[model samples]
Target: MITWLTIIGMGVITYAIRLAPIVLLERFALSPALRQALKFVPVAVLSAIILPELIMPGGGVDVSLANGRLLAGLLAIFVAWRTKNVLWTIVVGMVALWLL
Candidate 1:
């Protein structure tokens, strides 16, 4: 009983935590510059999260051609740039990683 109650309480708390930001921000009108900057936030955040893993698969920096992840990531970037297709980029990256 206590475990279930704790889980329910945590679910409510998590929902409130996520909902509060949207509720509060809805009242304010963001500036054009801020809105434009927000467009890049996802990309920046993703890069910050993903770059380390690709560059340091073994917990140490490795930028050499021997690093499969780094190589695959580069190929993925190229595919994304040229094709502008997320699906192709992911498929190519995964295949490149497997081959490497």
Candidate 2:
């Protein structure tokens, strides 16, 4: 019972923390510059999260060609740039990684 209560409490707190920002933002308008800057936040955040794993798969820096994730990432980048298709980029990247 304690474990379940703790899980529910954490869930409620997490939801409230996420929802508070959206609720507050809706009540106030942000500056155009701030909005523009926020537009890059997702990309920047994703790069910060993903680039490290791709460039350094074994927990240490490894930028060599032998890195499967790095090669797969390059393929995904190429597919994304050329086809501009998110689905295809993911599929190709996954298949390339599997093959490598």
Candidate 3:
């Protein structure tokens, strides 16, 4: 249970983190090579964090084929690949999970 002040403090901290990059990077101009490399940094970092959650969310890191979340996530990925729409992917994943 988060208190109001705690939530507000988290919001303030998050705000500061969000603003920090703009404030710090405003005066700098990145070179083309560096800019291209930097563009992938966020995706790499986000994938580093999200991949485990998608496939091995149980914290035990048990990647057995019997895992329901892994199956559901694969179904979601297939749906996303076929439809190229998040709404459809979510709907299909929900249906798969509900029926499982």
**Which has the greatest TM-score?**
2
Question: Taking the tens digit of each residue's C-alpha lDDT, what string does model 3 give over 1-100?
Answer: 5698899999999998678768889755567998899899997998798679767777777677667777777898899889999999988888887675
- In candidate 1, what are the lDDT values of residues 1-100, reduced to their tens digit? 9999999999999898678768888765678998899999999999998899899999999999999999999999999999999999999999999999
lDDT of 1 at 39: 100
Show where candidate 2 strays beyond 4 Å: 1-27
lDDT of 2: 0.93
Among residues 3 or more apart in sequence or in different chains, the pairs in candidate 1 whose N, CA or C atoms overlap within 3 Å are none
Predicted candidate 2, C-alpha RMSD: 3.8
The CA lDDT of each predicted structure is 0.94, 0.93, 0.81
Name the 10 consecutive residues with the lowest summed lDDT in model 3. Answer: 60-69
- Report the poorest 10 consecutive residues by lDDT, candidate 2: 21-30
Residue 14's lDDT within candidate 3 is: 90
TM-score of 3: 0.64
Better model by TM-score, 1 or 2?
A: 2
Work out candidate 1's RMSD over C-alphas.
4.5
**Best-performing candidate as measured by lDDT:** 1
What C-alpha lDDT, on a 0 to 100 scale, does residue 32 get in candidate 2? Answer: 100
Model 3 ranges off by over 4 Å: 1-26
